[model samples]
Target: MLRHFLTLLVLPGLVVNSSSSRSSSEEEKEHDDGSREKESNGHHSNGHGVPWGYKDQTAWTFNFTDCSGKSQSPIDINTRRAIYDPTLPPISLEGYDLTDDSALTLWNNGHTLELILPNTMRIVTGFDHEFLAAQLHFHWGTPEVPGSEHTIDNVHFPAEIHVVHYNSKYANISEAASQSDGLVVLGGFIQIGLHENENYEKILAVITDVSIEESNTEIPGFNVRHLLPNKLDRFYRYNGSLTTPPCYQTVNWTIFNDTITVSRKQLKALENTLKAGQEEHLNKNFRAPQLLYGRHVLASFMASSTIKNPGLGRMGERNQSTEQSEGLSRGDILAIAFGVLFGVSLLCFLLYTYQQHRKYTSITKDPRQNVIYKPAMKAEA
Candidate 1:
């Protein structure tokens, strides 16, 4: 009985030690996280420390220093102020449809959800040079706050997706990132609504798998075109930098005017699903709009056109022969109809006047007609 009592006492001590060790380990982990966050907020002796792109950093003032470059990005796209450049060609996205499972890896990079794509994808034309596909990522905010990086006329959207590419003229994406005119990013706005955006299902369904920071999963390749707006012709273009830092000023941005829809539930999944540390979810991952300075924002569509009558500018340059067959506007057709009717009426009136003059001449001047209708005929009648 004494031995049994001693075993029980020892067992309680062992349990206490085990609990204490676990608690200490957890605290140590938390401390490590806190230290990392603190260190990242302040500048390190070396150039690299925490990712300079993180929004959570509070100490280092230098994180925003790169943001003040001459050509920073996420500017407000004032459509009215934008220049209508007919030279801005329709952007051609090559190999956007990925079917091989081995080509795709979806990851939660702690800051945002990123997808690794194969280099087979590319931008054939649009800019002065060709840009090869690198990868894609997202920026989003909570349900209440819209989080798109680039705003339209200062209006924000629920989310945004950036399809990043590198100037193929350079060796690779990393090499191109620091050079001017070395990157081209296709930005698409994401709006929340009632119906499920079928195109978003590929990304949304995988959110649960990578709910934690640094978590990743290999996904079967999907049609990447679905992620973009249906109308790629109309877009806002400008010279800018990566919204993230080392805020490279190499990016030539093209933000689509058309917005893709995401269901409210999917947006909730995005806002609440991914987490940075054990503390909380990734709420706001977007940087606010940067200043334009003296930069020009060019548009692919004509400025005179409205959203209802949006012009598909000069498709002939991209696709040969076949034009955008949407046909003329009602106003254009009406003008043509009025022009035709005026021309026909004028012609008919001229012809009737000519005929009357001809008949009068024949009656008055023709020898036989004159003999019949002259004073002799009147006297006979």
Candidate 2:
């Protein structure tokens, strides 16, 4: 009958809705993967068939121990909850102004686009010792999904660039990567806008040459400073690990508050680029942010205002790092100066009143003049 047919259709819809809710509820479980036992016991080739990608991070071989580590990278930076510490100084780049073309090379690591720099280029300050620049890479998503590894206030940016470095105190990157505070990574957010960042274009121009995995090419070396934001003082600092495999918890992360603008054309080039051993475009090359787990995110500069959740495409309004990053603002300085001046004036007034009262008491208590003035005159005669 017609009624029976309609009931069948309604039952299918009800079942689909129930399944969808179950799926969403499963995802809401804080991203905790309970299938570790099954994943570990399953025999996959040592490195050949290791299923490593953005879709399933448990398949990564190096992350067996750190998959559930307390300290992880690409965390959500809630600026409102960050502590403003003036002691965090502005990062100083030592040899980033590379005029020598021989110093730079571009390569397509299976995961992201990478640019290798010489050890001469290093982060001179912002740590107990210097951190030598090893390499820099980017993570991005498609036009629809923002792929930045780290998010601000749970809002994802179009992309993110990580400048990886090794601590100078260590012999090499291998040794530094295992120790605490051994690595320093400078993170900068990228946003899609109308204008192109000519500085970033230097590396993007060679996207075709390194289109495949393990492919690399030479590029005319430019100033590495161009890759970073103009302001480096205002940043969120925290202790975290690398996002990829071997998630070592040794990095000192400094993610800038400001963002660099890139054109849609450039973003397309990044998104459409091919990965190694894949015909499809390498899109959504980012990891979801992990829980904070009570980690403290320190800020170099005091935030003037709170950024609303999902504040994207508003680079101009973001905090800038400058000379005033660690010091009090002009208004704060004036307020403190006024308070000190008022306190000093009040103390001076109290001292003057006490002196006047003492003088009056001394004059009023001159009883010798009243009783002894005449006796003293007779004695003198």
Candidate 3:
């Protein structure tokens, strides 16, 4: 009974962590309409834009009151402290297998490169309601510092990706942003691996074009699913807010226990490619860990067990003509290796037993056989 009740707590967009809900004016405050494209010529420093940056994240509270809220985001996840809720289901994504996400706009939103995703790519499950894809952006660090927003066991990955979504119950993301039970953000940690991730080529290839703030380019879509950690079943769910300014407290955060990989070269490109509005290099854009303030982090899978994420990025490049297939997980590869070894050992044992049986049979049946053979040899001589 407790597990079932805790399952509700683990659900996306449902949180008991907020001390007090945002008031009517705060709730109706305007923001980006999830997937809508921002104007390229627009720049901050205007009354419309907030000048707050990573250099002074604390100052955001002055302008955006929600930033100081109890349930603010990008918190360090102590997996040991997280509640192990067996009832939490695997995050279900729909329409992510795009034949062509290439036509979609990839924007350099000044702070980070934002990929405006289509509503067709909605998360079908693992939430209280269907949530439409808004935009996915990345946060990263320089070689000196790790930049993932939400850390696992206080260890930061090279980068992280946030896929923002809004509940389908609302007309659009702008409408949903006002509700406490409106937004859901899927977070995936990014690691550097031996091979370059071809899945990211769609956005990485066009980075040069959008190096400047507010600039955007049309990107060809590969499978959008590849951008996420391969194992969606294991994740850390919590009630949090947008990691950036105006840090809306409406988001239900689900940080994947798994991590996706990119080549060192790709990570560097992601870290160094974009420029801030001042034309400075934009790196280490992640926010520091916020005070949990009594909010409980819930795990979809057992927290005690180590998750073997080994994302699909390791699968490496494939020809466009080749069919995309799921690669073997680390567990799958280990199982296959064990099966092969066991089969070889079994075959060797069977062969040895058969040889022994033949030798024993010949020895035991020798008297009658030797009598006939001796007669044949005498005739030849």
Residue 272 error for model 2, in Å? 0.4
Candidate 1 Cα outliers beyond 4 Å, as residue runs = 1-47, 51-61, 305-381
TM-score, predicted candidate 2 vs. hidden true structure: 0.67
How do the residues 271-365 of candidate 3 rate in per-residue lDDT, one tens digit apiece?
A: 88899876699888888999987676776665333232222122123233222222344566799999999999999999999999999998998
Q: Encode model 2's per-residue lDDT on 139-159: one tens digit a residue.
A: 899989989989998999999
Give candidate 2 regions above 4 Å deviation: 1-51, 58-63, 305-381
All-Cα superposition RMSD per candidate: 16.9, 18.1, 16.0
lDDT of 1 by residue, 1-381 (tens): 234222211221121112111100000000022222111011111123335544543332364454456777678987555656666778888888887554466767566777766667898988777877756778899878988989987999999988877677866544444456556778899998789987688878989999987677877777888899998998987777656543445567788988899889998898899988776787688878888876767677765432222232421121222124223445677999999999999999999999999999877886775354545335554
The lDDT of each candidate is 0.63, 0.64, 0.67
Candidate order (lDDT):
3, 2, 1
Instruction: Supply candidate 1's per-residue lDDT for 319.
Output: 21
Q: What is the alpha-carbon lDDT of model 1 when measured against the actual structure?
A: 0.63
